[model samples]
Target: MTAERGVHKPNLLVLVGPTAVGKTRLSIEIAKSCSCEIISGDSMQVYRGMDIGTAKITPEEMQGIPHHLIDVLDPEESFSVAYFQKVCRSLIPEIASRGRIPFIVGGTGLYVESVCYEFQFTEAGADEAFRQEQLRFSEQFGPEALHAKLTEIDPETAAKLHPNDQRRIIRALEVYHLTGTTLSRQLESQTKASPYNLCIIGLTMDRQLLYNRIEARIDEMVQQGLVQEVKSLLERGCSRSLVSMQGLGYKEIAEHLLDGLPLEDAIMKLKRDTRRFAKRQLSWFRHMKDIHWIDVTRGENFPDHLADIRAIIAGKFGIPLEYNYKH
Candidate 1:
């Protein structure tokens, strides 16, 4: 499927699944087989010094396969779907130009879909004063009050957003203030067409087993001193209010340290929240079109799963499968 644009758009292989569904290893193997460079689609992995929490692929794990977009921003810096889309648009073509496929790999459905579907973010410029005012309002009147304001102007969007999601709520309000158009309406009008030929692979497993993996991953993260990871960021003056610090592992652990929550309670909350996050990730991907699902069950032979994925890539995208599997 070539793009309508005069120039040829390269094929994109996207490997997306719920957290701890085993995307990292499989993606590396696929990249090796397809001769591709990976572009991480994860929202949290972009932040530097956030390795353990984000389960960022280490240099050892990457095994010499070039990766883009990980560890690019400071913990205090902000990242957005619009920024992700812009970076990927440039990186994808540059990777293609070098004769390597660009593999968009992560569980961040919104970030990946924004790139694949080519979402057009609102053209309305940011009103810093309005945003600051909304922030102050939230701090003074609380998040619920701020959310109520959104309900007045954009009930549809407010209904979808959590009261605790103050960033998005403020942004939605800012959009209405700037352009007199609701964020939901602006998104509704955006095109969902892709400029690249895409083959999206979704990984899955038995629900109980997936949950078990999530629990184990959380345990491993704790063992890796996830608490210390958050402590270092805070010590460096990174605020809890920053979007990066609000990520799953970092936020839960930060609460224990800063807000005086019990350590065990924080760990439990982290595990529970991570399980819920995985469920949400699955829900998001289910709505995506044209994904080839592969179920990798617990105790299953991994090489067999890799072979299955390789065959799909070759058959669907006409990419050569040169993966050397020593079966």
Candidate 2:
């Protein structure tokens, strides 16, 4: 909640916001100047074969800066906020030892928050029966219906999750029943305080423009063979109900392939759903105080946008934005 990244400590810069607001491009530019390495904060981008649908930047797109945590996990493997915070804790110090700034970039708010706010990951282990029951509920009633159940039991967790995130929905319900406590309370009770001082820079833009960009990007993803990528994952034994398949584009497309809906309809729904997801992202971000919001839409041009960000980073960290990108 506090944006006051203390002086005299290694800095961790987290760039987060609604999707389709140019986070990847902006993060790359900032990383180039900051002498930093990009650490992907996305959930779906962790899977190796989920390139286009996740809008993962290629090596060519990275322009030679190293990126970590993008393709480290198999599609069927489970990935949680606890796993992300664990990996980031190890990775940040290594990056700092190399004298490059550690920059985290993605629209996944919980992933960003888990690091920035130093939220703890409490492991109550698993409840097989509860997990199965919740999974069955998700399968029968859908992610949204389970989400409504979560709202009934734990509104805080429900508010944070998108209705399409079936995995999290199942997990939340499973946690509530397994521990006989709300996930929210357990999170607060078990949080291991972090040592890192953090700065979070959230990027946002106009709603209409953001939605337009989301739709356009969805079109581009489909054209770039998102369907083919999903098919490949399925052929590799990743099931439709796997944790990976619950990601935004993956679920909708998989549903289209299974049910009789046209691919076009699925594509349209995916775009619409993504736009809504972005809106929810913005809503979630606004609730967190002390966030330095950059309205890219309000800027007259890219340089102006860059200048505002550069100034904020300088003010926060007591270091000039100029650094060796040529390395």
The alpha-carbon lDDT assigned to residue 142 of candidate 1 equals 88
For model 2, where is the 10-residue window of minimal lDDT?
1-10
User: Candidate 2, after superposition: displacement of residue 212 in Å?
Assistant: 0.5
Q: For residue 309, give model 1's deviation from the true position in Å.
A: 1.5
Instruction: Choose the strongest candidate by lDDT.
Output: 1
* lDDT, candidate 2, 1-327, per-residue tens: 234535445788878899888888778888888788988998889998898888889988898999999899988788888889899989998999898889999888777778876786556677767777777887798777888999999999888777877788778887777777888887667444446666678888888988888898999999899888887877788888778898988888887877867999999889888988898889878876557888898545766676677778777776767633231
Tell me the whole-model lDDT of each prediction, alpha carbons only. 0.86, 0.81
Q: C-alpha displacement of 147 in model 2, angstroms?
A: 2.5
Q: How many clashes (backbone atoms < 3 Å, residues ≥3 apart in a chain or on different chains) does model 1 have?
A: 0
- What is candidate 2's TM-score against the reference? 0.91
Judge candidate 1 at residue 219 and give its lDDT.
90
